[model samples]
Target: MSDPTTQLTVLFMPESAHGPTNQCIGIGKVLLDRGHKVVFAAERSWEGKLAPLGFVEALVDLAPPDPGATDEAAGQFWIDFINETSPEFRKPTLEQLASFVQPTYQALIDGARYAEPQLKAIIEEHRPDVLVEDNVVAFPALVTSGAPFVRIVSCNPLEIRGPGIAPVFSGYAAADPSGWEPFLAEFDRTHQETWEAFNAWVQEQGAPPLPARDFVHTSEVANLYVFPEELDYTDARPLGATWHRMDSSLRETDAEWEMPDSFAARPEGAALIYLSLGSLGGADIELLQRLIDVLGTTEHRVVVSMGPRADEIRLTANMVGDAIVPQTKIIPQVDLVITHGGNNTTTESLHFGKPMIVLPLFWDQYDNAQRVDETGYGVRLSTYGFTDDELLGAVERLLADTELRARAAATGEAIRSRGGLRVGADVIERVGLDHVRGRG
Candidate 1:
């Protein structure tokens, strides 16, 4: 039970992507159970979802309304953009800095500007004691809300950098610094102008300036980042006092998933693999089709997350999937995971004690792939270039390696025992309580 005087009206503003929204939901639910009032200031597309989870939904759209359309819901701007730019995924990560990275950050900056006024209105109305944002880019409205602010890095912890550490978005190996300079040079070449302009805009609006080399501002009260402890870069880069690490804040609300009959009917002892490229990566029909074709030939049954364009790809006889599925519920039941190496999936597979074949597409996906591969927690495969033999061999090799499986299981055990959700809730609640009492 929460203290009567400590009850907080907390607002969570997460990125529209499923990973950040879901991570925030995990921590929000815990705070709700502790007698705090939790509210989510999300985009209009999330209308019916958050309310059912017992949160007060404050809807805001990142793009302007269309005059003619019945549903002028603006979140589709990102989905459409990703699909249109799918060709850039084939480029080397360094080259993609100009094509994919800059454009993506530009969109985020535009979104922050568009949503600021609406967010200001919501903050005024709700008067939350604490504000939390799970995003790569910072929003000035959140920082200047006169409440304790928290930042959740649902992406790879490499987003927070140190001098000797590898650059954030580069997919460079953890053990090597050879490529760091070139990647940093490329990142700056493409990102410096936009980042500086955004930072200036933030300060002009009365918010603290963003940290150097970071697009998001670190919270002075409390900041939490999600990544399994075993795979963290603590030895190389130690964080400050305000920083806290949560293994993964997996939502506890997902309904228990029963394996479909097709998978259940597979021959005994056959390995089961879960394939998801996330909502955005899943947009690439050609890539998904290629993966489906290769996995179809295998004896093992597969469960695929078809993503936003599920209908475009037909699953093989040994597989079953829909546009949306219970990822957390299913991860525990699968023997292996083939993922796009999104932070959520990478940490989640670890939390469930499952090994992965990290097929990173872009952004920090490369960093995650390298981290897992080098740590022996998983294998990293080429997303666009993996051959049938490479895919088939990885599956066979991972399933056959008992020692690696045991190590992954052990890491999962430690992470689950740590309970990142509860820890994050505690920190958030403390920050909220302390601030309300003028102690923060």
Candidate 2:
């Protein structure tokens, strides 16, 4: 049973197109069902995904006008567009509460103003005892600037963990925190700038500047890792704050969700390898062509989630086939995943005990790949000068090495036995209650 002392209100934002937005929603649902008051500060586009999940209140339209349908395809085009047109838009748009990107800052401020009246009303109406928020929108930083509430930072694996965890990048190690001080400093610096910028915006609206990342280090701010604990990640041991592992609502197989009959005819008993560059940026055509050339002849049956962007690439005679589904569903069935090393996707693969071959393109992908490489659980390959041989070599190594497979499986088993949901629930309850007790 939940504690009677404190009521929690969570502000969630799913910012990026390929981001782990649903994971945030799933965590919110778990809290909401437990009788906490939760509110999501998200994009209008996420409305359809959130409405069914029982979120009645939201501070909506946190992004620009839908990038239009032209940006609907998540692949090389988007990556090229981001690089060509606007490089800073990717992380800042998602991470910053008030971005420095010109009109973007103005747009967010305006959006905040539009959302503030409604958000203020909800906060006043609900009188939440605590607030949990994604670091993306900095809603916690904005709304509870001086208010008293436990602030929990919600994020996927790489964003939250120490070095060598979930392969987001390579310098941090789980066993040793001091080893990655430089990277940690950089991470803190990035957050500091983001918060300072956000504080400037808040001050512009006549609100006081709150503390920086140091606030998070204190008991008042807690860190909650949202990926399933069953995943073999680096430095998963939670520190002073609580840790919550979210269960993927994705069932192994659902009768309603349909795939092509030709693709789904029968399970290929061989080691099932799933390939998805994720929904964000990737060299769709080149990577797809390379995969087709290599995996087509392999002993493993490959299933590719083309992610709508690179659907045109046809598999050669060697590959079994491919399908397009959320990786949450696909990773469970596959034996290994070849990905662009997005933290969420990597964690999903590890959650299911599947080994991975990380081909990072940009942002946190390289970081995630580095973690995988350093840990010996997987190999990280460069896509910058990728060739068919390089792709084939990585795939072959993952398939041939029994030790890596066993290690990955062992890690997965350890995570499964840890009671992911229960631990997470306990953390949430404890932290939320602690906030109330502090008031007393």
Candidate 3:
């Protein structure tokens, strides 16, 4: 039981993994240890990921309503809905944005309104002293203002600046790159519009708008899971936020995973490489087949976790060698991770200190791959249909490079020594609990 005087209630909106959602879950784990009553308040999709952590969940049906829908019908509809809705917003015309921003922002505000009755009931029933939220769920900030508690924002990867680590903030509008200089100008403008919409929503609800920096700058207690020593945020004009490194204590591997039975026969000296295309992209069947064909010819043992869509690609016997395995358990045992630069996979590879051959498909994957290249730890593949010879060359270069391997190991050690889980827990505790007191 928590100390009655020190008990807190933190409401976080975690979307799902493959983005900032899982990162929030990691943040939540630390709060759980403090005996704090942390409620993961978000779309119900998050329940599967949250249940394992022993945290309580309060789901809001953010999904659109459809009466008389079957289970499969709902899944199919949502997948298509997400796919369609995603692209439209990715490149909205200024006219479209001007017309739609208010309604879209209002819908989110409505989400808070819909949530209000339930939240009010809960609060009235069991008075939580604080509400900590992800900046993505901006409406909640407006909904819970001036309560007998504090409101703190937790920014993951921290937001964009001149040049350091570019933590990709989702729902941020992309610039219309019709012209290079103008596009650059619009980047700032787009961010301003985002803040404006948020501010407009809050102001209408009787709460003060957040500082311009509040929506963009690193929070007073932000958790940058990446090792600070390894980050090159020299271009980042920081806003006095305390930067905490990732915790090593959070890295857990099951003892039963000593070695998969399939690896027992593989020649002990052969190098092993792990490949994954991440969750969203990397669905190139021909590309995957080509990789299998090339990897089979090499002395190195190759493992591929083709993701949920792996079966779509057919593989031959050589590609099926004992070397291949799913990432669920294979990552800890590999020497190199050939991946699509998804944040989670990259972070995990870094957590293990494994060098990488990053093939970013789209979105932040490119940014992540760029970070890997800039940091001198990995090489990014163009993925523009590299010929067999070109792909082979890149693979050979990475495999033979002792320096890359050493840097990766060193980076991993640095991250591991920093107490990844504990440090994260401390920062979250500070944000979720201590920040409330600091409000005074």
* Clash totals for all candidate models: 0, 10, 6
Task: Please report the candidate that would top lDDT against the real structure.
Answer: 1
Give one digit per residue, the lDDT tens place, for model 3 in 278-375.
55443454555677777777766666765444656665443342222435357778788888776667777877788787765544455566667767
- Which residue ranges in model 3 land beyond 4 Å of their true spot? 1-7, 67-130, 135-137, 142-158, 162-183, 188-195, 210-228, 234-236, 242-258, 282-299, 316-329, 431-440
TM-score for candidate 3: 0.74
Computed on alpha carbons, the lDDT of every model, listed in order, comes to 0.88, 0.55, 0.54
RMSD in angstroms between candidate 2 and the native structure over all alpha carbons: 6.2
Clashing pairs in 1: none
- The TM-score measured for candidate 1 stands at 0.96
For each candidate in turn, the TM-score is 0.96, 0.71, 0.74
Candidates 1 and 3 compared by lDDT, better number? 1
Candidate 3 lowest-lDDT run of ten? 169-178
* Full-model lDDT, candidate 3: 0.54
lDDT of 3 at 165: 34
Report the lDDT tens digits of candidate 2 across residue range 269-347. Answer: 4466788876644335556667666788765666776644455577764354333565566666667798887766776
Error of 2 at 375 (Å): 0.9
**Scored by Cα lDDT, where does model 1 land?**
0.88
